[model samples]
Target: MDLILRCLIFSLLHQSLYSKPYNIDGLLENGTGAIESLAKPLQDISTKDYSWAKGNQTCSQLLKDCKEFLDLLPSSSSWMLKPVLALGFLQVGCLTEQEPFFLDLIKDKNARTLFNIMAEQTNNSIHPTTTNSHKSQPDIQKHDLLRFNLESLSIDAQSISHHMHCSEIQQEQQDVLLKGSILRSHSSLQHAMDHCDRVGPVCAGVTSDTLGQFKSVARNGGYIIPHVGSKLWLHHCTAGLLRRRSTDPECHSEKELRIHNVMQWIPVVSGYYNAGSAIYYATQGCTAQAEDRAIDASIDLGYDALFTATGGVSGAVSAGVGMAVKPPLRDGVKSAINYFKAQWSG
Candidate 1:
């Protein structure tokens, strides 16, 4: 009996030593279960009909449901669990009618804890720690982790879209879909902007400024881009010009330089033209292109005015020359120009 016991102990130790370290399946199952539990309260809040007469009562019920749902969230810090937590936050935020109540609930200690968890998880996911331990791991493990995170994000995003009834939710879903595609293609920031442009003005309106900041940072070698609003306009114009050059061969040829010179000589000339045309169309009850032209004119006028104040004719000419060049230094040069423009605007 002593000999049998000794043999059994040896077998158990060997098995333990060779076992797999990570439990991918277990984590996925736990995530799914947590999502299901959290989803129930959100669904109830979304589908119920509340009359204005019962507004206060409805608000109270909404807060109760949100608080309970938040309380049910698991406290695990595993990166795998972030997706469901993100989904819960998104669902609660989409409750536009209960905004006031929802705002109040976030003040609770428990609600703040969950929000901090999500924010910390997001930061860690974006800039993962690279310690000695992480360095020792195989590349395959890192790849698998990334793939798992993206898969989980996609799944939870779909779930949020299906259950939430808001335009903002739909926009978030579209952003997730675009991000996945952008990752697969391994394209530059400019390419991502192009994708947004192709998705139509709604997508562009939503993502343009953010993408512009990203592009500016990338072009500046990871430095923060300056100017809150002016850089945004310059980036928008640069992206528009880049897109135009890509789609229209004429914009790339030597002939385009002449047109660029014309615009350079008469600062804000195109701004005046576009603004006049916008006013004409607006008076005639035409809306489609009128609004777009008006926006363009505003950007042009702003760009010219800001640059003229800071660097005068030289600045305006330099900016025009920068945009007229080919794609090599387009983003970097434009960013530099905007930096000066931003300094003056401030």
Candidate 2:
């Protein structure tokens, strides 16, 4: 009798997993879930007209507000805050690393299913709709932009990090590095979640603690990028790291130069993109491309300065060779680029 009852209960539970359809109650928890805070983009994210809704909020500001909201909430209702708190770590880490905060939205089981649903709605062949159809639209274009600003960052960045993400690498040492990278990503996310579960909806006093955690995560994530250059990290390790500042001015001033370059390029590149897009009445975003171009331009301009400083020894030959070589090199880098591009954008 006991065995039969147990078997019956197990059978019913198994069936329920497949039989139950996606329900709002599962994700929203009858308005108790805080996934809304993370996902609340302007209405019609598929279109371009939506203004400042909750989803369009910057991750830094959104996090500050989320923390405040959690602080004010009642203890009994704290479960609702689980989504943001767990997501906050991923958001901050990814954000500082300059990756997308939006990807953090679907990390929760409920939100993951919600994301799948949102993604499915935009499907054309299966659930095709007219241009004005709201039913087919996803509600987060910021999600789209940030979604494009993936952890790999660019084709160059992807090339460096590919070993860490690739399943096909057979070398034991690289496999270790890959494991470390994966572990950092998962561990950081998990640690935040567990901490939040213990702390509750309101992590009233941990502002410094949370920021520190994010900064550390954003800094390296333990992937072993030599000299902190995402481009050269994989391809040139020993010589790049060990080379004297005298011999290689590129490694010497690379960090400061890159930051300076990016700062200078952001406005110019973005303005260029905005102007062209406006002229064409194009709605598809140019921000991501503008950013990549800005980085590339910055590197070029920085090298021009560097070569001038080095009296054209490092400047002309290196820059000239770079100008000659970059197109082909970038074309070669496209394999890793395409993989992540397809994986994220698909």
Which candidate ranks first by TM-score, i.e. highest? Answer: 2
Residue by residue across 34-128, what tens digits does model 1's lDDT show? Answer: 34433333221222121221212343454354354334322211111122222232333334424554445443332333333223322222211
TM-score of predicted structure 2: 0.17
lDDT tens digits, residues 1-346, model 2? 6456545643442222111111233333334444553355412212211111123335465455544544543322222123223332332231221234444433444434323332222221121112432311111211121212222222233233223321111111111111012212223434533443343312111111222331112112222211111110111111112112212432222332222222222211221222221111111122243223322332222221111111111111111221111111222223334443463355
Least accurate stretch of 10 residues (summed lDDT) in model 1? 217-226
* Model 2: how far residue 288 lies from native, Å: 44
TM-score of every candidate: 0.16, 0.17
The local distance difference test score of each candidate is 0.27, 0.25
Clashing pairs in 1: none
